[model samples]
Target: MAPTQYSQPERFRIALGPLLYYWPHATVLSFYAGIADSPVDRVYLGETVCTRRHEMRFAHWIEIAQMLREAGKQVVLSTPVLVESDTDIAVMRKICTQGDFLVEANDLGAVRCMERRPFIGGPHLNVYHADTLAWLAELGAVGCTVPVEMDGPTMLALSAARPAGVAVEAMVWGRMPLAFSARCFTARHFRLRKDACEFRCEGYPDGLVASTGEGQAFFTLNGIQTQSATCLDLCAEVSAMADGGIDYMRVSPHASGTGEAIAHLDEIRRAQRPASPSPVMPADATPSNGYWSGRPGIGWVAEEAGT
Candidate 1:
């Protein structure tokens, strides 16, 4: 069958991506408690990063999902980006078979585990074309998040040719997850083995920022995941996204100021105007939107540049 054409929603939707960092159990609960009352239309839960961060097990995530559902928000469970061990596969199976909440499949293994059940294609699924989107839709993907490195025009083209009933989501905010490895960089950074690393990632709630020899901010290391040094803020592109048939704008969770960030984006979406480049990051962090404009991932292209 041919790939389905893109369909736009009457109103733009905002989703909270899965928490990529490891926090204490209380902190995680507290964060979602606040999210239950936020303007976010959907909330993605579960550990999409390393599974060693066991602050919240699958049951705990379900509990949070139940609470959020009661608050009138849609919830999804996200599988890990990298599935290294049998334990990971087992967890993925548990999440896929639950049939309670929707699942976001980050890897193909998770996709297969879902057994044609409706799920969301996560950013790491590497879907970059209409054919791939169509294949995923055939496998029961209700929506697919564009890869972080996909440029804006490319996303528009893909959206234009996407399969029917498959909505397109974009990562409009947060430090972009660049890559994943079986080896935990955080463990190596701490001079310990990956298995004996003693949960050091929890120390850096926002991931550890790697710097160049010249002290320029480089990649951020969060266990097995490598991320951009600067947060990707596409709030300024909300109007363009709406014009291009994007269905949802995703904001990855951060340690602080996420509530305010969600609020700011909500206001811009409701007003249906050009965004004013609000402060979504902490005072110390930098913001970049170059990937959306077909520039280097670290570069920030101004709205007036139009290039």
Candidate 2:
């Protein structure tokens, strides 16, 4: 029998991605506890970067996951983007063994470790074409996140040709993750080795910013991952996403204003009106949707009167 073709939802679901910055254990726990009442449909857990900064242990993550699940939200454990050490591999293996909750495979190694358990293709995974999406689906990926660099036209094409049973998710709001490396940029900035550096990332509730020589904020350093200095606010693009057949919109958690951001997006989804004129940003963050509009990643082209 032929496979069932993928179907688009009338409205996109809001998913809360795993926390990227290191925060105090209590703060991390409290944040999710409050998220249980938020309008988010799915919540991703586990440390996705810099395992050295262990504010929440494996058990703590599981506990929070259970709490969110009980609150009627689907929970998915996210593996780190760069799996370098044996310890990282071990944790990835353990998370894959979690039968109750699904896993999001950020690294290709984690994809192999999942062993046919249906997983979500994390943003770190390179999924640029229909065949790549099909291959991942053959390996049991039920959903896949589009890379932040992929523009709307490209995404529209992929969404049209994606294999049956696979869904495409986009990062609708938050700082775009630009790149990941083995060296810890956060520790390096303090002139310390990655292993020996004190947990300084916890000091910045959100990741620290890196400004250019001319003093323009260019990127955010979250341990080893580099993120766009400007947050990608697609709050105004819900109708565009729905028209393109996008299945889900992943909202990366911020240090503050996450609930308000999700609420605004929820309002847009429920109303099904034209895109909003303004974009919202959390405290100390700027807005940009240039990449989605097929321009440079940092440019913020304002919407026209009717666009």
lDDT of 1 by residue, 134-233 (tens): 9999999999999988998999999999988889999988889999998999999989999998999999999899999999999999999999999888
- List, in order, the clash count of every candidate structure: 3, 0
Give Cα distance to truth, residue 166, candidate 2, Å: 1.0
Clashing pairs in 1: 4-162, 4-163, 4-164
Highest-lDDT candidate: 1
Residue 98 lDDT in model 1? 93
CA lDDT of every candidate: 0.87, 0.84
For each candidate, C-alpha RMSD in Å? Answer: 4.9, 5.0
* Candidate 1 stretches greater than 4 Å from native: 1-10, 304-307
Candidate 1 lDDT (Cα, 0 to 1): 0.87
Worst 10 residues of 1 by lDDT: 2-11
Worst 10 residues of 2 by lDDT: 2-11
With a 3 Å backbone cut-off (N, CA, C), the pairs that clash in candidate 2 are none
TM-score of 2: 0.94
Name model 2 segments beyond 4 Å from true.
1-10, 277-279, 304-307
157 in model 2: Cα distance from truth in Å? 1.1
